[model samples]
Target: MNSLPPLRQPCPPGTCTCRRDELLEEPGADLRILRLTRHEEQRLLERLENIRSLADLERLQQRMYEQLGIRLSVSPSHNEVRSMRGIVIDFVEQPGLCRKTRQAIPAAIRRGLERQPEIAYRLLDAHDLLRDA
Candidate 1:
């Protein structure tokens, strides 16, 4: 068995489920939070309404970085350093996604995020902080 702890979903506190999504709008203690500008929100929502495949999700992810300047490198639980791809994968899998796309988003996101880098959670340990102590 792998000695590493299981990866926690990168959902922000209280916003993991669709039931509490309003809290996401208000913001909370997510490590790498993506704060959206009004125009970006509008554009993202419009794009989400039409997402049907992995490509669509990838395109939106790129658009957020390129156009809106929104990118989050989240440390989900102080162990996992999730890149933008991982963050976007988590975001795209939210319940807000259309029902037609919901079931497949997780798998798609997994494939995409895995392609980004190794599954190793790059975290800072006490040793690194105080070397030779």
Candidate 2:
């Protein structure tokens, strides 16, 4: 007789065992969302290299606000903005690019935006950094 609780069936590797995991991992899981591109990744990595401290991150944050036309006072709790700021700071602090950047940055950026249009259209239209948005 089995003494322990019956083992649960293992989820298939390609199956959606966890909706949250699927949402987090799949790039094309949702079409309405704005995704981060390689150019933005490269740009962030390159620009972040110049930042060596929190002061630099703060300056960059200001620049992002000015350049991206983001008003923190208006959008006091914007995640997309904060995500971008964090990405730059995290990238700079590390010696090299994090392997998880491609997946992580876009997700973070999406989280930070108050609306899909903010990233899907407006920011892309305003900023020249993105190769194609």
Candidate 3:
């Protein structure tokens, strides 16, 4: 009588049979996408680790910001943001990259936080960009 999650594990004794993750059971774990798989983290984080300089990091940063629907800057460093799902994502970036957010952060943008906590992604209401409110 409802919908199913897009991601999944093998049917025959897979590593995690967690269709109902403990995290999701927590309070405020809205229907937003706040979960990550180890495999995905490995793939994307690999690219992030290859960054050779601040410029490179900035380039990736820009791509992520623009492509991800985040168009607001609320700080000098990539501290964190909360998506419409209400999950707080933390990012670690340069001194002036300026973490961004907008109407609502997409679920896939959690890459910044999943890999190394180096960068976090959270969507904020364009009108309510708070510093962890």
Residue 83 lDDT (model 2): 36
Candidate 3, residue 128: Cα displacement in angstroms equals 30
What do the candidate models score in CA lDDT, each in turn? 0.39, 0.37, 0.37
Report lDDT (Cα) of residue 38, candidate 1: 33
Q: By how many angstroms RMSD does model 3 differ from the true structure?
A: 13.9
In terms of lDDT, the best-performing candidate is 1
Q: Which ranges of candidate 3 are over 4 A from the true structure? A: 1-22, 26-34, 59-133
Q: In model 2, which range of ten residues has the least summed lDDT? A: 69-78
lDDT of 1: 0.39
lDDT tens digits by residue: candidate 2, 26-109: 664431111223455457545544444434434655664454322222111223334333222222221122235533543444
Error of 2 at 40 (Å): 1.0
* Candidate 2 TM-score versus the reference: 0.25
Q: lDDT tens string, model 3, 1-133?
A: 7975443222233333333354346765432222223354345346555544434545765765554322323322333434323443344322212122111222233333344333332223333456457
RMSD of each: 15.9, 17.6, 13.9
The residue pairs in collision within model 1 are none
The residue ranges of model 1 lying beyond 4 angstroms of the native Cα positions read: 1-40, 72-133
Question: Order of candidates by TM-score, top first?
Answer: 3, 1, 2
- Runs off by more than 4 Å, candidate 2: 1-35, 61-99, 102-133
TM-score of each: 0.27, 0.25, 0.28
